[model samples]
Target: MYAQPQPQTTGRYIDLFPYIPWLLTGGMVFALIFGALWERTMVSTNLLVNPDTAAELKPIQLKKEPIGALRIDVNASISYNQWVTYEIQVKDQQGKVLASGIKQAWAESGTWVEEGESGTWAENDLMGGLDVRANQSEPVIIAIDVLEYSDTAGKEIDKPVSFQVIVKNGVVDDRYLWTGLFGTLLLSVLALFTVSSTGKVVINKSNPDSDVVARAICGNKDRLIRVVVKVQSDEYSPSSLHIRLTVNDANGEQLYSQTHLVNVKRSKSDGKVTSGSSALTTFFVLEPRGSYGFHAEVTPDASVDRTRIIVRENARTLFPVKVVTLKSSDAQ
Candidate 1:
């Protein structure tokens, strides 16, 4: 018999259906991440007041200067408990009402209603933002002016708002705060370095005498403040180092300078290289409304043990000497 025909072998191919679920899950994860980043959140970014209210309350009206009408744009929405009569009042310096009435304020739906997100305010779209500058340029008799607020029943809010306005006399921009923070960091780092390497340094208020002195004065038309520092060394000793201080107001166009010379003379002791003393005094000239801080740098003659002291009127903080030595190999 011819070779018996072997039974035809049959094989089944398994479908890749199981992997579809895994591929789908991976795609979903990536999609979610992309969607989160792509989503846009539009709101009144320069929100001066914290609208993240804790409870049944509106944003806190922070104390700030009224830049006439030029500084602000207003959008408002209101709901009223009931139709109630409200009054407007602007006060004088003597706390007397200069004007009071229901002054007509042009109101409309803000153009920024893009899905409850605060849209950008355009110059032309400045709604109902009555130019308070015309009446606001000079000190007013009206105790208050409703520049703009969320309304209650188509009427101005009569609710007693706990708000006050405080104006900054000079420019205190982001740079100022950043630099201040940086300076503070530098001081802290230096302080730590000194402690780790040498020992403790202290800051103390200086007693004014022949060796130590302090003086301060305001400068410029805008009352820009500057400092002048002077230190005169006497007795022709090696420890005597004269210090000159100069301060200039960086607040405005006009720069003013004030200076004071203080003497840093040798003490009445052995004129040893390491046996000497130093003192520092600071002067501050503050306007009726202004904020300021001191910036100080010190230079010593040769390699004397100089004191890094921060002195105020009644308090002083001292930083230690940080000697950074270099090894010959490291230098190479």
Candidate 2:
């Protein structure tokens, strides 16, 4: 009788699908690093401001980019529990206001006791930024006008404050980068579960005999096979069970053999003791495209009241396996 050919398998491609998201994540990391390095500081200076005076800085020459724009950042230093509101403006050499906005900064501190635990707390936030896309290369001026200065209790304060101003070229909008990275990471996590392929069950028998045997065919030489054995008993059973698993080629030549000691745990339901069960699992790859035999046996068979043997072909695990070959073994 002529033997039928096995079906073509796409197991290799399926196994590689899970890594695509990780590759995207790596690319995102590279882009983020490159963007941070590409940015250059165009201006860094400090301005002193009185309660009712506007600080005007020297003219700054800015070059317009063909693709992206520049960024302006301002930070204020104020006393505790005090707040300052200021107006920022970017003007052309002719004193025309091209862009303008109002911003505020404040700092506060206090102590609190909650749930019998006491601690001191302090919070201070002081920074603002703006994006500018120059239509053409020109000289411009940056002006800061302090509008109001007061304490948190609505008391006016008369004082001089220092402000740090910064202008940067090639500024990258990290909002999109961060959003893309977050989405890619989520996809990578989901791929671990959705992209993995499941195997076909070759044998699923309950209450199997002490020495059970089954035969299965290997469609792909690169795919893995899994063997799972479950033993069930009662409270009187022993604490552990010893199991032996063996795989043989079509010619009755042993290819793999291993022994495992599985610890039995009594299952509980509604705070009551139930049946006890223990399981043993092993994985191996069959390189030859042909039929193979699986054998399983349990020691001290009297300790197990029921048994189950599950053999699966083309098994895909959550993580990649590193296969190592030895002169006398073919399992890992």
Candidate 3:
């Protein structure tokens, strides 16, 4: 009777209930970050124009051999806009403007659509015109006749001549202008609302640390598009990370694929894996002028959840590929 038990303390349980709101708030914040990352910083990329600059020149050897021409493919990727303009210029190594008569630009009508996005095209709208729309790309053939060459010094012209292709002008429809805003919001939501996941892969235009974008590679047929895939692993895990990647064409034909592994090191004090990262680089060849499908698949170790992987494609988790051709009149 003297050892009666005191009332059990309920304060411990009450204190945890207050933290319930905090825990819920923290969870909501993390979910928003995850959503943004999954969306790839808003799915909004840039309107890219390839071969920002080009230059090549040689001396004429023979009159009958015909004047050589500088053939360059001017390509504009309309990812966020509907239309843009490309201005082509031919110049000597001296920076003097060459005559337009030596330059010729031709494009096949109804040959393309926006590079990454989808849309309908009419016969009148082709790569030939100055007004370029989303997903459309064409080659501009600049033929500089070496046979008619007249050097200023009357000597062998042995200088590196240059040809310039630029995205001199761009105009977007008012309706589609919202893409910029929407894209920003999408990214903002990603940054503010979602938490980054471990064991994730991010595809960027040129480098792993750069902004992720679907790029348009133009110019030479053998030109290569370098893509960087960045992967991450848990800081506290005990095991190393292994990531396998596969690339395929739109027809489901395999193009290129490989697997990468990252080793984890732990601190002596923490005895944890410590955060780890691995960057992988792969190249894709640009094909002749025609839209083609291409994508990449990433598979992490069984221990890492599949949902933790971040990729460009939302549902299929594959990257898309498109090819455009650049050729001279003779070659075309």
Candidate 4:
């Protein structure tokens, strides 16, 4: 029998109007991104002002990116050769003077400005300052510090503030560092969360019988050796007797291993055999340093599918752990 062919309808371009919403959505998203970046870059979130070249300081930068930033080498040029005074008004978000201090110093018209840990300014030319191209100094560093208020319920007041601008060159402009380390722990936890969320950590292929990611304490990186033994798959363990295992090191050098037996028994007037030491209980321990790895095959052994690894340290277990110096701890 002959089959008749069917007719096909040509499709028309009718979906353009439907995609207008998506186009508008995409444009809005693009504009929003640029606007957010512009706002973040232009508007300074810091409440501290650094008129002279100074590095504004804050506590530990929560994320890898810094949060507190002040104007250093600002775009507008200040008229030099005369006493051009600049004001560093310190206040909180509500415009209250949290604390105030100065990073006083003298420098070339437009040299690099550096602030010390206490916000003190100094010329980098003295402490390894640079001689930029065209034989011109980059900018002058500013010195600064925080002055706590002892009267206003233990608050620093800006009253009786200094009027003259004291300029001195060649002072170290170190960043005002808040190094008590409170939020670093929070940052670390966030970092771990990011890592786990991103799953960038790759677990190298190894035997399943040993602990792949074991927690170990090493005193130092120098003179330390570690060995891991892994038992392969256990698919054949149920019906079969014994299996073979091997271990190796970074250089594929074999260190310690032995063949084991398993599942040798009988019943109904038959003699059964049993070993007291199970291969699962077998582990290794080496001293000082060694080159390693091994395989274990066993017959009549308990769970040779399980492997043991020997880890060694620098004969010490003192690992450094940072803790917060809380006010409560201080009182105690």
Each prediction's TM-score versus the true structure:
0.20, 0.66, 0.24, 0.18
Candidate 1 residue-wise lDDT at 241: 47
The 10-residue segment of model 3 with minimum total lDDT is: 60-69
lDDT of 4 by residue, 1-332 (tens): 22222222222211233334445445555544543343222222222323333333332111121222232221112223212223333333344443343332223334444564334333311011111111222222232322321231333334322222222222222221112122333454444344212211111234444233332322122322223233433323333344343334334444333443444222212332222222232222222233333444455444434444444332111122111110111111
User: Where does model 4 exceed 4 Å of error?
Assistant: 1-183, 186-222, 230-293, 296-332
| Tens digit per residue, CA lDDT, model 3, 1-332 | 12211222122111122334445555555555543343211111222223223322332111111212122333332222122223434443455544332222222224355768666543212132222222322233232222221232333333322222222222222223344445545555543322222112233333232122232223235443334455443454434554454443334444344455655343343654545555554333334432333233334433321112223311110123332222222223
Q: Which candidate has the highest TM-score of all?
A: 2
Model 4 scores a C-alpha lDDT of 0.30
lDDT per prediction?
Answer: 0.31, 0.74, 0.33, 0.30
Task: List candidate 1 segments past 4 Å from native.
Answer: 1-239, 246-261, 265-271, 297-300, 307-332
Question: lDDT by residue for model 1 over 1-332, one digit each (tens)?
Answer: 22211222211211233334445445555544543454322212221222222111122222234321211223322232322222234344555654444423333333576666776442222122212224323453322244434343455444432222222121223344355445555555554343222211122223222223222222112221212233323343354444433222224211122233334455553744323444444323233332222333334444333333332221112322111111111111
Candidate whose lDDT is highest: 2
How many residue-pair clashes does candidate 1 contain? 24
What local lDDT score does residue 156 receive in model 2, on the 0 to 100 scale?
89
Q: lDDT ranking from best to worst? A: 2, 3, 1, 4
For TM-score, candidate 1 versus 2, the one ahead is 2
RMSD of 4: 26.6
| TM-score (C-alpha, index-matched) for candidate 1 | 0.20
